[model samples]
Structures are given as C-alpha cells and as structure tokens.
Target: MEGCKRLEQLPKSIGSLSCLTNLNLSHCDRLANLQIHILEQPSPLESGLQRRKIIVHLPGEINKLSSLVNLSIDGRIHIQLLNLIGDAEHISCIPKQQTPDELLLSRCYVLKSLNIKRTRYNKDGSSFSCISFSDFHSLTELKLINLNILTIPDDIGQLQSLEKLDLSGNDFKSLPTSMTNLSRLKYARLSNCIKLVALPELTQLQTLKLSGCSNLRSLLNLSHAFHERVRYGLLELGLDNCRNFKSLSYQVRQLTSLIHLDLSRHDFEEIPESIRELSSLGTLCLNNCKKIKSVKDLPESLKHLYAHGCDSLENVSLSSNHSIEKLDLSHCFGMKQDEHLITQILNDGFSQVVCFLNNYSLVN
Candidate 1:
C-alpha cells in the first residue's frame, strides 16, 4: 500500500496475496516484526521498498520467499531491519547489514543486485570471520562500499553475470584471483581503497577506475593490472595519484582501443612514445606531472590534452591539421613560442580548439 503511514503491523491475512509481485511498505513506520505469513502466505514479495523509518527487524523468514527478487533497503533505519535477521532462521528480527552472522545471502539465488553499503562492526564483538557469497551467482551488480572488510571472499568470482562491482573505501590489500572470473563485468570501481595493491585480470572490463589506491606496492608489483587491460582492450582507465607507478609497460603501446586515460599527478617523467599509438585516444591528462619536458606526437583522435602543471615543459609540437579541442598549458613558463603561432590558432576560422598558455614567452 502506498500511503500506509499508520500501518503498524501487517495482519496475517495480508500475506494471502499469493500473486502479489510488488509490495510497497515504504512508509510503514510502525511495522516492527516480520512474520512468517509475510514470507510463506499471501504471495512472494517481489519488489520490496525499504524507505520506512520504523519498519525495523525484517524477519529471518525472508529466506523462505523463493519468489522474492528485488529488495531496496537504503537508509540506516531499513538497514536495521537486516541486523535483526541473522543467518539463523529463528531470528525474529533483521540484524545490522554487518551481522555477526550474515549467512542468509546464499538463499537469494534469484536476487539480481545486492547493495549492502556502509557497515558498523560491533566494537566489543568479534563474530563471523567471513561473509558468505557462494549463493550470489545471479547478482548483476554487487556494491559493498565502506564495509571495512580486510578480505573479500574469493567466491566473488562466482558472479558470472555481474556487470558492475564497486568496492570503494575498504581495507583490503588485494583482490582474489577468482574476481577475474567475472566474464561479463564491464565497470569496476575501486577508488580510495588505499590498502589495495593487487587486482585480477578482467578480460571483458571496459571501465576500470583505481584513482586512490596509493599503497598497492605492498600487495603486488605495479602496473601488472595495466598489462591485463592492454591485453583485454580496456576503454576507460584511471590511475590518478597511484603513488607507486613510475613506468608503464612497453606493451602499453599496444592499447589501441584506449579512449580516456587519466594519469594526473603520476610519476612518469615523460610521455611514452607508445601513447602516440593509441589511435582511439580521446582525453589524455598529465596535470601536475612536473618533470615532463615536451608535449608532442599525439594521436589523431585526441580531443583534450591537459598538461597544465608541467613547469619544465619547454617545447610543444602542433600542426595545422591537429584536431585538439582543448589544450591547457598555463603553467609552462619555460616554453618559448612565436606569438603568431598561438594567434593563428586562436583566430583561425577552422580552429575550434581552446588553448590556455598564460606564462608563455612570446618570440618573433
């Protein structure tokens, strides 16, 4: 029911809707207990709305509903509904998302997406050493953000249908090799996982973001993951501030399928000659790469080139046929160029590129 604000408790007869596919108990603030009748009787609850602030303690009986497919328990209040529902079928209430015994996941075989984000472990309690995942093979998107788990179960690889996986802000040092088994995975976000050092090869992955994985060196050597992307033809790659990256694979030249590459604040002193081989390269970011000395030999497909903080950059190569859309070189005080060249590009009827060269010295 949409406006069931005062619906304190669902009656046993309410579970009699056998064919009921979607259940909207979002505003049922007074609902406290999840009875078995809700799981076994009226009908299999298909679409569950969990916006209710007072509907806490979803019963362990939820496991009995084989037809239950989608469950959205967003906010801390709805999350409390889970805390009381431990793996134990006898639990009268749902436990916190980080239950001492979160063993019921295996029962949800048809669940398409399981997003259990943000957890608080009991300070004085040390319970389950592992969260079970052997049963979530059908999950298409699995997001376990900020769980603070030290390790992810290797069974995560079993999600053969998974398309997106976000494991940001965790303490894990490395990913299990089983993660490579996600054959259908397209997007993977591991940002701010400061302790993460190693990653598995994702062959079908299209977008791989590892923005703040600064400590990856302690877990694995650098850039082995990049080689995996090169082999698999990744399209969008973000390695911003990956502290340990000093060199790129020679095979990086082979990444002809790359579209967007973000290397801002990285340690590479010079642009790789192999980068010119990326015929599909669209955006190349080298912002704050202070040691870079030159900017030249870009691929024909480049649309945006950002090298703003390259203070040592003294030379740049540009031709009239270039297709650059935006070029940022504002801090390159060392570069000496003819004023006419910049003027021609800015005033040319055929030029659509926006250039920023604030500190450049104009020569005759």
Candidate 2:
C-alpha cells in the first residue's frame, strides 16, 4: 500500500490478510469513497492481525470488518455497519445520522460503549421511532446529545452493565421504572431536560445531576441497597432550579459520603433538622430559596454555607462550637442583626469565618 497518498478505495484483497491485528489509516486527507462491504469482511491471511481491531477515519463504510472488535469512525456511517460486525465491542461514531435508535438497539448485545453527540434532527418529526434500545445488553456507557429526543426507551434498564449515562438537552418527561435495574450505574447527568418531572431509582448510583430541570417534583427513595451504597459512595448531588421539591433533609442525611450538596432555587421553608446529621458535609448551598425562613441546626463538619437571596429568612442561629468557617447570608430581607451572636463568633477566634452582616460591621 505504498504511493497510496490518496487511496480513493481500499483494496478488496486487503481482507485476505486475516492475520492483521491492528490497522491505522488516520489523517489520509485525500482518501475517500471507502466501500463499507470490503472493510466489513475478515482478511484471509489468518495472522494475528485478523483478530485485531480496526481504526478508520473514512466515512460510514466500515460495516465490512466482521472480525473487528473495536471500530472507530470519524464521520457519519451507514446503519448497516451494525449488522455486519459480529463481536464489535467498541464503536465511536461522529454524530451524523438523524436517529440511530434502530442501529443501536439491533446489535447492542455486543456493543459496550456508544457516544453520539451534536446530532441534529427535527423537534416534532417521525424520527423518534428510529431511536430504540431493546437489545442493549452489554452497554456500559451511553452518551447522547442534541438529538431532540422526547423520551427514552422504557427498556433502557436492560443494559445491566451500564455505568455512566448522559442524556442532556432532551425532552424526557420522566424516567422509566425499568431504570431501577441498572444496579451498576454510578454517574447520571440529565441537565437541561426541562420537561422531566421525576427521577428513576438508582440503587448503585453515586453521582447525579439534575440541573435546569424546572418541572421535576418528587424524588422517591430508592431500594435499601441503593440507599446503603449512596451512603458510602455518593459524593455529589445537584438539584438546581427544581422548584417543586419541598424537602430533601432526610435523603441528604443518608448520604454520609456526600461532601458537596446544592439545593438552590427550591421552596423549602427552613433547613431541615436532618441536615445536621450529615457529618461529612462541607459545602452546602441553599441560595435563591426565597421561601426559606431560617438556617438552624448547623452541622459540625460544615465549612461553607450559602443562603444568599433568601428573602424570607429572618433568623440564623449557629451552633456555639460549629466548625463553619464561611457564612454568606447576603440579601436576606428578614434577617435581624444580633450583636451578641456576632461577638460570640468573633471571640471564638475562628478567623476563617467570613460572615456577612446586616450592618456591614465586623463581629469584633
């Protein structure tokens, strides 16, 4: 394959080299018109390379590599490539097709990771039927973005090996019950899905982000195992702009490993007493919670607390020996200045505590 600076088509005889294990044809800018069927077939040489993987930078013509274990493509590819590869474990496609539900769900039994991003499609079109996930058995990571999807397949939980899933900027109204079966899942991000109303039970999940989901209301407790794992493995949880959630005190306490928790823009009237039970909590943000009236029962491990823009907050009582070092109560309308509490904090010699006062005076 010399002097092939601009190979327009792959040699069909190349498949005869069945021993070929690794083939790298990257950055051949002049290479074009690669036929899918030729690349899909296994080479005949029966050498070690025959069992190896294939990496191609050409268009969607890679369905010919039936022996390929790993297939990496640069741009849009033919959907038939899914049916040709018998044991393809990894597939990376540059977002090109309108909807890949059928191609993805068809041979998902062997596929492990699928990354599709920046795909464009009609918002209210028939393309929804093309996105299915009935056979995703070995899938571990699924990332779909800018697809304009309205809902996810109810059988998504069938991917028992799934660990990380990102479905941002979609139109899902609620997660399906089958999602509870994803016991191996650890990280899930559903940010900017404004229509979502509730979250599915994640028994083994550790990190979850639901930012910008305005319609979300209820987040029921998961199974006992789920709660137990979260207590140890869960580190961060974000629920920004979820106005419908009124309380998360009990749930927050269960995550003993949580170091950072954000519950901004909610409607809670006060920080729940249960929050004080979070011994590992270090940063707690309740900013823009206009309905909250007080901040009490401070946690001993807390180092930073943000309650800014809480218009209804009037009284904030800190525990005498609390470990809090930074307190931001700025713009709290109903807060009353208490000189005694301020003096007590200053005398404690907790020089790190940056308290925001109503009169802008130092506690000393």
Candidate 3:
C-alpha cells in the first residue's frame, strides 16, 4: 500500500470475506479506514512504513474479527482489536510512532504471553500510561516494557499460569498484592523502574533482578518469598546498582537453595555465617565491599569467589575438599593464609584458580 495517497476507505463488504487470512496495508500514506473482520488466522501483517504512516480507523464492531488469533501490525495505526478478540493465545501489536492512551487487553481471555514493548527504547521518550488488563487469566508470560505505568491492577493476581513477568522501564511505585497469587512465577525483571519502591510476596519465585532501580529502599517481606521459594528449590538474586537499598529484613540462613547472589557496590560490612547453609551456592561476589573484615564458614559448594577490593578483609576460611574454582583477593591488604592450605586447594581443583589468585596473595 505504497503511494496510495488518495485512498480513503475500503469497501465495507471486505469484512464479509469469511476465508480472508492476510492483510498488508503497510506504508499506505492516505488509507484511513479498514472494515475487515479477518476470519482465518492472519499471518504477521507488518505495517512498518519508514516514510509515512498507514492510518486505519477501526469501526465499533465488537464481533468483527471473532476468529483472529494472530495479528501483527506496525506503524501508527489507531485500532482497537481487544473486545473483538476472544480466545487468542498470542498477540502482538506495535504502533512504533504514537503513544496511545490505553492498550486494551480485556478481550484476550486465553492469551498465554503478551508483549507490548517499544519498537525502540528511548530514555526520554513517551510511553502509554493507561491500559486495560483484564480477563487474561491464562497468561503465562507478560512483558510490557517502556509503558510508563504507575500501578499494576490488583487483578493481575488472576494469572495462575504465569511463569515470567518483565515490566522494565516503567513508572510503578508499588506492586499490587494481587501478584502474591502467581504461585508458578519463577522469573521477574524490573530493571530501570526509577520510581519503584516495593515488591509483593512471591511463593515460588526463583530469580529476581532489581538491577537499575534508584529509589527502591528495601525488598518488603522478602522473608516470605525466601521461605517459600527455598522450599520449592534453587533460586538466584541480583541487587546490582540499586543504590538506595539499605536493609534485608529476611533471614539469610534459611535460604539453603540459593545458588547465585550478587551484592556488589553496597555499604554492608559483615556477611553472617548463616550463609554457609547455602548448600547449592556457587557464585559469590563482594567486590568493592570496603568495610568487610572477615570471611569464614564458606560453603563447600562455592565455585567462584570475588572480593577484589575489600580493604579490611583479614581472614578467609577454606576447606581442603571444597569445589572452589577461582578466588579473587586482589587489593585485600589484610588477608593472611597459610601456604599449605593454598597447596591443598590447588591439588583438588584446577590450577587456574590457585595460580591466578596466588599472584595477589600478600607476602606475610
């Protein structure tokens, strides 16, 4: 649909094509109305026009496309296919140019995964704030990045089959209590949400990444999530660059199934020996923890250890039979270890870990 500058409307009978499956009105500069009720599942209908946008004003027909399962459209097209779409399992709609007020998903009841992300990410660009999220109980994964949403509807707790959720780069301040209902949810990424301040309780969560948030002061009720997920099995947590995080209210000793943890660039001083309860712990990074003074009760399952810039670090506990691979103690001026213990670690594990760390051992 290129160079059709005078095209204003399509024949109204176009919606009567009960067997019509494909529609490509992309790049149509002057096209304004599309009276189509696609019967069969249409293929990816791309409307990515680099020069001019193809305008398609949808009519108020709720029963129009009752059979559309997949409809991929790009470019700035103002159309509402929500109420007209019922039982769709997958849906993607991208209007790369304009920021519409609402993205209605109240009609896709059986949808398993829904993504409404920006065609491109811009730090200062505008994003949709108002959205209709309802009746999508069967959703398993939901990614709505760059939608300057300030709050998630409490009804989101209705997604019982949800496994993953990515709401990065949004404007939410507090998560809904409804998310406490996602029993099967395992992964959540909330990076770059600058206004986010809190999270809800999760039962079976395994991985939670809060990397770029700036105002988050704490992980509210983390003990509940830790207790529930640890009972369910292994998990991972990352708290990188969350500059305002000031406390961990949860009991750390009970997290036996935690496999990976990142507490880099924080102001904490001591790591409790209860950390030894992590039988599955493999990677531990304490880089730049300037005030840390001792390290003991290291877990046997540990495979990598990095404490490169801990200026006051003095003691490091090691077992001859541990599975440790690499230990970075660079710039740790206060650490003192027996030469014999180093020989034992080298004998049981690969030479790379021992020799690499040995170069930084002090001359005491």
Candidate 4:
C-alpha cells in the first residue's frame, strides 16, 4: 500500500492475513487510521520456533504490531509526526527471499541509521519525547535536518556507538551537554543553524563543520585543556560564513592538529598570524575573503592554499621553507598591477608550485 496517496483507512477484516510478513504503507499522505491485527499462526515457510517479520513504513499508530522492529522515513512520506512504539527484543529474522534493502533493515535488531529531513509538524506543538535512544544500541549514524526542533533529549548521549551525526538546518539554540559523551563520534555537521548560539564541547570529533551558523559567537570552550596544549582529535574544521565570531586567532589556536581549515566568506583583513602555529596544517582555504588585503606568514607544512576571489589581495609572501605545491590566487586583481609580487611568488625556490592567477592558470 506504499504511495497510496488517497488511502484514508484500512479495512478491519485485513487482520485475517495470517501470512502477511511485509506491509509498506509509505507515501500514504491521507492514512489517518490503522486497523490491523497480529498474525499469530506461523507460516510453513519456517520451522517450529520461527516466526514471520513485518516491515511497516507506516503513518499511523502501530504499538500493537509487535513484529515491527524498524521504521524508515524517506522523501515519499508526507506524515506530520512519525510515532514509534514497539519493543526491540522480539526482532525477527528476515526472509531470505526479501530484497537486499529489506534484508539490510531487518538484519539489525533496531534502526541503525535514522534520517528525517524537511518534515512538517503540527501547528499546535511538536515533540520527539516518544523516541528513546537506549532502544537503538547499534545505531551508528543519525541525521535530523530542518525539523525545527528546539531541544534534543539529553539521552542522546546514550548512543555510544554513534559515529557520524549531522543536525544541520535545525532551530536548536544549544545542544545538550550530554552529547559530549558520544565517545566514538568522528564527524559532526551543524551547518546553517541560524539560531544556534552555542555548542557543547566536542573535543573527540575529527571533522566538525559549522558553516553559516551566524549566531554562534564562541567555541573557546571546545577544548577543556586549551591551556595545557592537549592535542585534540579534530583534523578538518570548517567555520566559513560564521561572521559573528568575535576572534579568529584564539578561536583556532588550540586546534593545532587541524590538517584542513576553511575560513572562507569572512570579513577579516588578514589571515591570523596565529595560524602559523598549526604546524600540521596542510590545506588552508581563504576563498572569497574580499576584505583580506594580503597573504603572508603561512605555515611551512601547508601544501595547498586557495585564496581566490580576494580582489583586495595585493601581496604574496612565502618563506623559503614553504612547501606549497598548489597556489590559487585567481581574481586577486590588486596583485596583477605589480609584476614583482607575482615574480616573487613564482621564485626559483618554489618551482614545484602550480599557481593559478587571474584569467589563466600556470604551472611552474
């Protein structure tokens, strides 16, 4: 019954399906009521102790369906709220004749990856209080986008196996401090969260992307051992378009382990001299930083520098030890007037560097 857009209800007699193993009612925009009974008789398809399983991409209440252990929502579903109610212990083994997709969902005792993006909610008020994290112990990846959720439950920290979490395009002002307890978390993306004012300390994360979070004013507390110079696990950090941050120097001084750093679309007049302290840094992106007038004193370990669209940029200063192999300065018209600056950048010491200038690219 999936994609049955006009399906408003089901017949009560449909409960007689003693061998019904799969029921997918996804994209049923008008489904308002569910009237189905559990099929107690085991099919000859399985032996004595075996039971059949059901996969429901449903829209209504399904607490009575004990065989349903997993629910997946996609772009096809038009439901307002996804109500989840069931036990996890009675998970059934998937039928061998099932499609590969169904087999993947049934293999796990509970949902492993739950993604809900751009979902509309009721006007009265909305809540995800019914969902519990403890039930999904094996869950590894979770993404909740543009849900307009104000707060995530503190129990979110209980997802100890969670590795990647993307909560972009939401309305939360702050995350629960308990989120820091996700010990295995590696990648975290919270982009375009316009109203988000602060974030919890996620020192264990490897990749943290927070682009377009305009209201986020600070991340100084991201490292509890900032003064002690403890190396954080963060390797790639993106803060592009975060215009309201008070300081860029101190903001990243503690992130010395960073390898890729993106500071694009900012209004700063200069690349922070403190960036030189990131000895392990290799790729630095300063694209579209129109207000920056010069590029100087970069890290020696840097291998790629992308500073294109910086029209006010007039100077290029590279130390003899700079190992930059790819340099992009396209659209830095200010430096075009001074041939010496280009010559200095293309000096014999950096013959291996491939430079991209305004209107044309060159390999030296």
Q: TM-score per candidate, in order?
A: 0.65, 0.62, 0.63, 0.70
Candidate 4 Cα RMSD after full superposition onto the native fold (Å): 12.2
Candidate 4 C-alpha lDDT tens digits along 33-130: 55454444555744455544444445342322234433432222223324333211111111113344654555223445656554432223232322
**Which parts of model 3 are misplaced by more than 4 Å?**
1-110, 119-127, 220-234, 246-250, 287-294, 307-316, 328-344, 351-364
lDDT of 3: 0.61
1-364: candidate 3 lDDT, tens digit per residue: 3334455555655544444433444434344444343323233437642322233433232222333234343433333344222212122632212112222333334455666565443556554543445655667788877656666777778778889999887888989888877888899989888888877655467888777787887664655554454344337877766668644525445456789877666566676556777889998887777878877678889889888778888767777667777778877776655566566665665655642242545221
Q: Least accurate stretch of 10 residues (summed lDDT) in model 4?
A: 87-96
The TM-score measured for candidate 4 stands at: 0.70
Best by lDDT: 4
* Candidate 2 Cα outliers beyond 4 Å, as residue runs: 1-130, 133-141, 158-161, 221-233, 246-250, 253-257, 336-338, 358-364
Q: How accurate is candidate 1 locally (lDDT)?
A: 0.61
Could you tell me how far off, in angstroms, the CA of residue 75 lies in candidate 4 after the best superposition? 3.6
Question: Against the unseen true structure, what C-alpha lDDT does each candidate score?
Answer: 0.61, 0.63, 0.61, 0.69
Please provide, for model 2 over 110-144, each residue's C-alpha lDDT reduced to its tens digit, 9 standing for 90 to 100.
Answer: 45676554344334522222245754466778876
Each prediction's Cα RMSD?
11.5, 12.7, 11.0, 12.2
Positional deviation of residue 208's Cα in model 2 after best superposition, in angstroms = 1.1
lDDT of 1 at 26: 49
